[model samples]
Target chain A: MSDKDTTYQVPIGPIHPALKEPFMINFRLDGETIVDAEAHPGMNHRGIEFMGMHRNPLKVIPLSERICGICSIVHQHMFTTAVEHAAGIEPTNRARYIRTIMAELERIHSHVLWAGVAAHEIGFDTHLHFTWKVREKVMDLLEYIAGNRVNYSMWTIGGVRRDITEKMYPKVNETLDYYESLYKKLEEIFLGDPSIRLRTKDIGILTEEEALRLCGVGPTVRASGVKKDVRIDQPYAAYGDLDLDYVIPSRYGYENTGDVFSKTLVRLKELVQSIDLIRQCVDQMPEGDIDSEPKKAVLLNKLKKADGEGIGRIEAPRGEAFHYARLKEGQEELDCWKIRASTYNNLTTYAPMFMGEQIADIPIIAACIDPCIGCMDRAEIVEINSGERYSYTHEELHVLSVEKTKKILEGSL
Target chain B: MNTIDLPMSLDELESYFKEGLGDSISDLRKEEIKKGLNNRPVKLIWFTVSRGSFRKSIELISDIQIPHLSVTSGSDLGDVVELIYHFAVNYGYPGDEVSVNIKVHLPKDDLTIPTITDLVPGAITTEREKQEFLGIKVENIPDSRRLWLDEGFPEDRYPWRWDETGMENMSRYVHDKEEAANPPTEDTPREGGGKDE
Candidate 1:
């Protein structure tokens, strides 16, 4: 690794075999070691937040779900909660419980998806296949319960648009049992296997201090030994009533190795917790009206005065998602609405993590944050060589990334 | 937690801005604010004013020191370009949700306002996106980088621009498509579209 040796620059991209979405990372490599790294985002800017203002308030529900497909329910929940706050309506206890069940279901599906992705990233093809196979059950259950697998538009302004009937309870219970059993098997595979440990342990180590400074959220922050779960800090929905512990890695079986393994363990354990929470919601379900009766249609026809400002904070699967809205006196739509995804705050740490790490470790290290790649797809990267600066298109980078990743996987296998 | 009660009704909140803040607020009505549909509270207040007063209004309202700037949303309203700056203050506490709305209207001709990045640092990235998308000039903002703007996109082109018909005509062309398709050979021209052969 001497200075005279020819150094190579490796670009992992907006689309690669390892990632489902778009994001680009450039690694300045000295041999196998990554000496420097830079992350460029903005590749998938849909301008959905801007669209929120122009569209009708009711129409925004479907639009909000499009914010992030994997975490669609959370997006809908956040938007609906903000609308509820704006409208000054408090949902009933049963409605809160139903919302919590949906939220937990989403968390389970999201974590399982990440686990599968993590497996694929590390060249664990069998594990990847197995995890996704089990994940299909959860997705199927989601579709059965919410009428759709990805974006469950169940949440409405005042309460859930639909109710979980008694007939649905048995199916819910069966699904929970199946997921829990599958989780046990997956847990053994992820934690008990030596290869899994070797690939992840001590690699992509994000220390507690780095986690705090970088404002990392979700499992990434939890794995680093920070006990800042939004469920505990600001409990919305039925989470306020549940006697559940925020499953941090430090509390459980694993010592804080500050590595990808720790993050994996935290996410896996949270999957179990999500299942248990859903079970509790279903068992103690109260019989009540699911939807609020619509007020007089005449009241809705009038031009509602927009007044006051409010902030809506929800813990999306990635981490804390925030929305701010202000209403003007006579405008039909919101005067102001601002959204900050957890990834926006957490992505800043990519540079530090990538630096001083091996190029092979980049995928897992980067994916450890579970970044919202779609959010950052709009950015373009230009490389400066000698005096000339050449721009790299996202498509070019994506193709190169997939080729390199496939090569790496074949070599590792 | 106990239910929080605020001193002002939705109309009072609107009046506070109209008389106290001296700005025009829109979308405020007693019926909208009072209606509790599905047990969810509906709070409403609207304000509209000249676009020139946006920065000042933001500065004045944000003086209360709300820790979080939740989001900033911009929309095209045919004749006038509307920008909304949402601020959250002490809403969690009982009797404290007196949220303020300061609306600023920018005529089609002049669509620029002073950037509030100095006051709220978190607004840096979102403000840049809005500026480029809506063709709004945010003066005094720290970072001027073209966030979503890249090669093949015109400097003045806006992605979210809606004309009187509310259609976005901004096109994102592929400037490097040719270069990508026919990569530079050893003898191609390097400076321009192709490397010297």
Candidate 2:
């Protein structure tokens, strides 16, 4: 705790206030500058992969959706696509476009949600409120399409559960027009703000070399100038039919410094790109059956007969989300199911990014990668060794967070 | 960005591994699921090799233009547990990306394989995870600590295994009033509770 003590180590959390989910970070510091850092994630692990193995292919779709609250659609999309791939059931062209539209809509909402969180971390509450207000439109569109706001159970093994009726087209177009019109305003608030630039421009810089070496994916890698996107590379859904562009920082005015600013720019550009993608999917959507085979019993029979494996991946809002599935012939349950969320790939880069950053920049730097511990938290119910259930109530957790914030503010932490 | 003779199809990619690695890979099979439900053709190359050649096969896979290590997952396959290392090659190119799966089967008697963290440091997390959940010991891994499992979690009680010693009872939620009233508790003599080493 003393300034003279060179070997000062500060442990952040298994549960922290700034983070949306629970994950611990230990920072080894020399005075105020971090010399080394380690991230201990998986506090909220629900053992979703383990759960998926016991359930049939048709039943695991909803379980996959619960992997993360933000990127629920991406999880479902990947899992269903993998199962569909393994079963050799090709979805109708209309179904593929619908999937594409839903995924892009999810991306728009997710990016805006992340922008608000990043803003709040920097103590800019107004930006958080405004960004979230604009984000509601996307959420509403999602709710209208799938009947739920967060985990839309739209993805089925063979095809989507619901169809976008002709009545919904005007509503979808209106939402797109609104977002396109607000793009300049959103850019001005996020990119043009002087304070935002000052806080994020040079902080948490991840070089292209570090990015590739660490296997960083999604916007995190894009921010670093490594032009890789699973959407562009392995064009799934309706992504192949539509013309696409990779959203990298250098394409805009910013240099490929891979800083928090670069990441922010990439995400903002992606929001616009996602808007364009949704428009394209809607316009080019063909008229056909959503499912190759609609009956549940027949679909299950097809999956049962298929003795093969396939891997499905998509560029989620944060990064590349992958699902690998193996189905044995004449088996009700999955032979093998593995999910690798983007946060899992992105977390490896944390040590390098946090190495030389000051303690004050920890929140922003950590938030810059958009680390979602919920996706990585694969916890299991192990018997408590202490023979005591020491669980915190919501109020207690809030009070503890407030006390920690106070300590951080007073600079005694 | 010079396309210096990239493998044009799944067969070319498979032959590249065969010609390049020789007998290091004991069994090799490529399953091409051509544009099934999507435009992306999944070229899955299943490489089964002896435990001794596991790391070498990965290094050879890395030599194929530094493929991104997607995820390393394990499944209990009767007497042997199959550890599948999924890698994505040629990203950012539409319909050119290949899913190269290098699978190594380790018998239940000897549950260990050399770690690829040195080749792909990003693989440390997945290796650690496979070490925990599937009980597949990753030798010479940079970090030996548990990745996600709780500290009090009993050792050798892998969740993925449906066989004996696996915690299959907890897989599904059954409303047992007796178990709920008094949860099982045995002190695990481990340091840092559940923190990584």
Candidate 3:
């Protein structure tokens, strides 16, 4: 209580949107500068792993996709791959290519959707609307391929449930071409815009040492000069066949500051990278069956008798995530299933990033990680000395962020 | 963050561990799942280590490079809790990364494993998680306050355990009342793993 007498505690929380996974953070502040930020995630731990463990292997496929609303494909892909590896079922080469294409398309849409959120966080609604509008092409492409916008239930135990027929190639190419065309404009707006640079540059810096020491992943770590992309490091699916490089800030001559700006740069570049990867997969796709074991009963029987543990790690749009699965002989359900999302690894890195940022920078910094769920729903500022308590709604926090942008534009504190 | 000129293959890595921690390792397996046009090898080495040598094995891994700790995946195997430390090495090099999963089985009575947060600070999350979900005590974890589960939830009942301490009685399906109350958890055949979750 004595320490609180000289400091304030700002708890931002209950970022629970529609009862999905939620997150919260408590910021210890002296004046407007953040001294330390402690994150309290798991506000709504749905016990999906518990749910998965209770069901059969085939039944868990749909359940896995429901783990994350944004990256349903990532969970589905990882679950199937883990089960397949345990059961010793090799997916066809064509199926791997199809999976890769779908994963990349999801990345495009996720990153684009994040751009809008980041824009909104910084009070740039115009950019948010613009980016959201630009995001339709990728979402359309995903829906066209998988038949669903969000939960594209494409994965089966052995392989994908659907095929990317020759007829779909034209649509896929058109979508990729659309992103390629808009890439420069998207870059100019996010990276070239003066206001965004002012707000993001030198804000929420996570040094390379901290990034590595904390084991950060995906664009979050890549932005900090850590070359830890799962696609390149360990090629799963069609990533081995496709030539790719880590989308670190240094690749394009920008310093790896690990700030919000560098993170934005990394995600934007990854957008282009994903487009190129999908094109590579399309060009090099082999002709074969999409599903290795189409009959659910047959595959279920195989998984039930399989006795092994397997791992599926992927470079999700957010970062590196993995699913671990174990199947014992004669067991109808999984013996063990552990789902580790990228955010879990990146969670520790937040304390370092928020060390010296202003309270206004919290929203953008939190959004910069592109956490699976919205995290800035509301905030309560506790003046510890007086024991006075008041809160800021998500909209009020948005105003503070926008006001910071306006102050930067006006050249006044 | 010392750099080795050439990353060792999965075989060499396995041999390194066996030679270094001889009797501490068991059930050693090295696999490569080939994929796509190039048939590039995705290597993985699975080995179970004695509880005493768990930290020692991690120290051996750090000798090569600051291992990228993916996550520690674990489950309750009735008598012993099986904790698998899923780590990745040779990260910078393209297509050279090997997943080294070190399994440590602790008797339910002991239910304790030393923390690797000293070697991999990032492992605190997974360590704390293993502590809560499976009721495994993470000895000397820097900060052991509950991570995922809230303060109100019953601390004694771990969700992952399929035992008396587990949430089996509480975990249920809406329609399957009888099935939920008396769930089928039968064959714990090999190495103490259960038949079903």
Q: Please state the error at residue A218 of candidate 3 in Å.
A: 0.5
Model 2: chain B TM-score vs. truth? 0.77
Residue-level lDDT of model 3, residues A1-413, one tens digit each, is 22555789988887821112478889899888899988888888889999999999889999999988899999999998898888899998888998999999999988998898888888899988999998998888788888888999998876788899889989988988888999999999999999999999999999998899888988888999998988998999999999899888988999999999999999999999998998888888898898888887888888887998888999899898999999999999899999999989998998999997898898898888888766467789999878899889887887888999999999996
Residues B1-197 of candidate 3 have per-residue lDDT tens digits of: 45545578977887789998999899999999998789999999999999999989999988888778999988888788899999999988899999999999999888888888988989999898988998988889999999998676676778899989887666653234444344445452223324364
C-alpha DockQ of every model: 0.09, 0.39, 0.70
TM-score-wise, the better of 1 and 2 is 2
Error of 1 at B99 (Å): 13
C-alpha-based local distance difference test score of model 1: 0.64
For residues A2-113, write the lDDT of model 2, one tens digit per residue. Answer: 3444545666666643446888776776765777778888766778887888889888988999888889999999998888777777777788888999999999998998
Q: Candidate 2 — which pairs collide?
A: A13-A24, A45-A377, A45-A378, A45-A379, A218-A319
lDDT of 1 by residue, B24-86 (tens): 444443323221122223333445655555565565555443323445566566776767654
Which residues of candidate 2, in runs, are more than 4 Å off? Answer: A1-4, A17-19, A374-413, B1-4, B34-42, B170-197
Candidate 1: which stretches are off by over 4 Å?
Answer: A1-8, A293-303, A374-413, B1-144, B150-197
lDDT digits (tens) for residues A1-413 of candidate 1: 64734456666565532356666666666776777776656656555765776665566778888888788887777776676666555566677788888888888888888887777666676877887888888788888888898878887666787788888888888888998778778888888877677768877777766665444566777787765565654456766566676567768767765688998898889888888889888877777877553452422333145355555666777777777655556666665566677777566556666667765566677777787673222223333344333444434433433444466455663
TM-score of chain B of each: 0.64, 0.77, 0.85
Against the true structure, whose DockQ is highest? Answer: 3
Of candidate 1 chain B, the 10-residue stretch with the lowest lDDT total is: B31-40
Candidate numbers sorted by DockQ from highest down: 3, 2, 1
Q: Which model is ahead, 1 or 2, in terms of DockQ? A: 2
